[model samples]
Target: MYLKHFGLSELPFRITPDTSFVFANRQHQEALNTLLMALQEGEGFIKITGEVGSGKTLLCRRLLQSLGNEWSTAYLPNPSLDPDTLFLAIAEELGVKDAVGLDHFHLVRRINRALLDVARAKKRVVVCIDEVQAMPLPTLEALRLLSNLETEKRKLVQIVLFGQPELDERLRRPEIRQLLQRITFHCRLQGVEKLEIGNYVEHRLRVGGYRGDALFTPGALRALFRASSGMPRLINILAHKAMLSAFGEGVGRIDVKHIRLASKDTEGAKSLRWFWF
Candidate 1:
């Protein structure tokens, strides 16, 4: 609503994972580089864990978008499926018929055949599961089995799991410890650090075409770092509200007062008040 008022081409603080607005702050860069390097090494299974709203989904999407033409990706946003259902989801993604009705045996053959077809056509498939913490134990086992698809030289189906810390905890289970051991690469994503908060805000603003001078003052940005605790989602939430607060008063820059007001009105801001991002 305030895009024009702020002379922005798009909403700078949107909650969605728009890769164009991805800020390559230290931790984000490290996480991406870690995953990219691991994938290039033909790792069979990789898991990336982060706190909720810490940009795992965004990173996953960015990875999918940036992958080379030799790569094809199947994304599973909801993984709370039974083993048979999980295969069905993969089959459906690969455009197989009777995905749900087939017995587990048929489902596996179908999925494996489809994957082989893709490989023969020269496209390696990567199955990326988001919120993998919700995946049933058998489903995870099924996923591990899927990773077993490989050519003589390299893996056919590489899996990338992006999820909250709970997913790591889930992988540590006794029954799933074997699956955890199958993970060839793992990376943990940390939130934006306080030093990067202001730059991050500015980067997003510029990406959204905010041509004005600094929209947030030094102190206000510091306060925001605290109130958001370096979490990108919360930072965007606070920054968006701070801008609105400033706009309401017909101002161009956000000060601490504006941040404080924005914090008071924002959910989860209270918990972060004790620590700066």
Candidate 2:
């Protein structure tokens, strides 16, 4: 609503996981580099863990887009499926049109064939599962078994899991320890650091097509960092609200008062009043 008022072409502070707005901050860049290197090595199972709103989904999408040609990617954003449904979803993603009603045996057979077909074309297939903590234990075991389908040289299908810290706890179970061991590469993602908050906001603002001077004052920037505690999603929330607060007052630049008002209205941000005072 305030895009024109702020001389922006798009919403700068949206919480959606759009890759175009992906800030190449330290943590995000490190995580992406790690993932790309591991995949290039043809690692079978890779794990990426981060806290909620830490940008795992966005990272996953960015990785998929970066794979370019020579790689076929399948994304499962929701990992709550049962073992049977999970297999069916993989099969469908691999181009098996009739994956819905197939039995477990048929589903596995189809997925295996699909993987081999992709490999024959000299292209690697990667399956990315998001929110993997919600996947059933049986489904995870099935996933491990699926990873076993491979040629003598390298695995036919590689899997990358993006999830919250609970996924690490889930991997500690006795039944799932084997799966944990299969993770050839693992990376943990952290939120934006305080010192990088200004760059982060400016980066997104530039991506959103703002060519004007600094939109947020120094005091507002400090308040924003303290209020969000370095978390990306929270920063977006607070920043968006602060911009709205500024727009309401017919101001172009966000000030400390606007951030304080935004923080007061946000759930976790209220405790940041100490920062304001």
Candidate 3:
């Protein structure tokens, strides 16, 4: 709604994980680097954990986009499937069309054949599972067994897990200890630091095609950082609402008052203790 008023080509704060709007903030860049290195090393399992709204999905998308053609990627955005269905999903992703009607044991063979075909092409296969905390424990063990498929040289497929902290708790369970042990690399995503909030806002604004002068005043930026607690999603929500409030008042710049109102209006940011004042 404030695009024209702010001289922006599009809404900069949409929650969708668009890689084009990805900001290479320190945490994100490092996560991507770690993923690349682990995958290159042919590591069997990689785990990345972050709090809700900490940009895990965005990082996942950016990593998928950055991977070269040498890597074949299978993405499982929803991990609610049972082990049997999970196998079929991977089969479908790997282009095993005939796996749909096959039984569980037969489906595993089908997937193994597909992986071998991919290996013969000198390409690596990567399976990325998001929200893995929701996946059942049996399915997770199945994933571990699937990871056991390997040639003498390296693993046949690598798995990357993108999830919230609950996934860590799940991994700690005695039944899933083997899967946890197989994870060769791990990275934790954190909120932007206080010092980086300004740059973070400017980065997203520029990436979203804001070409005009500063839209948010210094005081407003500081307010935003406090209100959002440096979480990217909360930052986006507060910033968007702040801009909308400014636009509604026919103002050209956002000030502290606008940020305060924006923070109060946002359900998530309202949980910040100072907002109750």
Candidate 4:
């Protein structure tokens, strides 16, 4: 609603993970580098964990976009499924023909064959499973088994799991210790640091096609950092609302009062009163 008022071509702070607007803050850049390095090195399994709204989904999407034609990627946004269903999902993602009504054994075979075909074409397969903490133990085991497909030289498929911190707790269980051991590389994502918040906001605004003066005042940026605690998603939510608040008052730049109003209306945003004194 405030795009024209703010001189922005599009919404700068939509909650959805848009790769185009991704800010390469230190934490996220390091995580992306770790993922790329691990995959290039032929690691069989990799794990990434972060808190709620920590941009795991965005990172996963960014990784998928970064891979070149040499890589075949299968993305499972929701992996909370039974073992049979999980296998079928993987098969479908890998473009296995007639994968719809197959029995468990046949489904596994088809997925294996698809992985082999990709390997024969001199390309690697990477399966990215988001929200992996919600995956059933049996389904995770099935995932591990799927990773067992390999040639004499290297594995045919590599799996990358993106999830919340609970994923670590789930991997700690005795039944899944084997999978834990197979995670050759792991990275934890942190919120944007306090110092980087300004650059982050500016970067998103530039990506969203803003070409005017700084839309958020310094005080507003400080208020936003404290209110969001540097979490990207929370920052986006509070920033968007703060912009709307400023626009409603016929203002061009956001100030502390705007951020205060935003925090009041947002559910998880931290209260500004505690930081005011």
TM-score of each model, in listed order:
0.94, 0.96, 0.96, 0.97
**Model 1 C-alpha lDDT versus the unseen true structure:** 0.86
lDDT of each: 0.86, 0.90, 0.89, 0.92
Give the winner by TM-score: 2 or 3: 2
lDDT of 4 by residue, 1-277 (tens): 9999988899999999999899999999999999999999999999999988889999999999999999999999988899998888888888887888888888888888888899889999999999999999999888888888899999989999999999999999999889999999999998899899999999999998899888888888999999998899999999999998888999898889999999999888899986762
Angstrom error of the Cα, residue 6, model 4: value is 1.2
- Please provide, for model 1 over 1-277, each residue's C-alpha lDDT reduced to its tens digit, 9 standing for 90 to 100: 6788789999999999999899988988887888888888888899999987799999998888878988877899999898887788788887777567777787788888888888899888888899998888888888888888777888878899988889988888898788899898888888999899989999999999999888888888889888888999999998898888888888777888888888889878754345443
TM-score of 4: 0.97
Residue 263: error of model 4 in Å?
A: 0.9
Q: Order candidates by TM-score, high to low.
A: 4, 2, 3, 1
Q: Which stretches of candidate 3 lie over 4 Å from their true place?
A: 270-277
Off by over 4 Å in 4: none
Top candidate (TM-score): 4
Candidate with the greatest lDDT versus the true structure: 4
TM-score of 1: 0.94
Candidate 2 residue-wise lDDT at 154: 95
Candidate 2 C-alpha error for residue 216, in Å? 0.8
Writing each residue's lDDT as its tens digit, candidate 3 over 142-208 gives 9999999999999999999999999999999999899999998999999787778878888788987
Candidate 2 lDDT over 1-277, as tens digits, reads 8999999999988999998888888999999999999999999999999988889999999999999799998999999999998888888788888777878888888888888889999899999999999999999999999999999999999999999999999999999899999998999988898889999999999999999999999888888888888889989999999999889889899998888888889877645656653
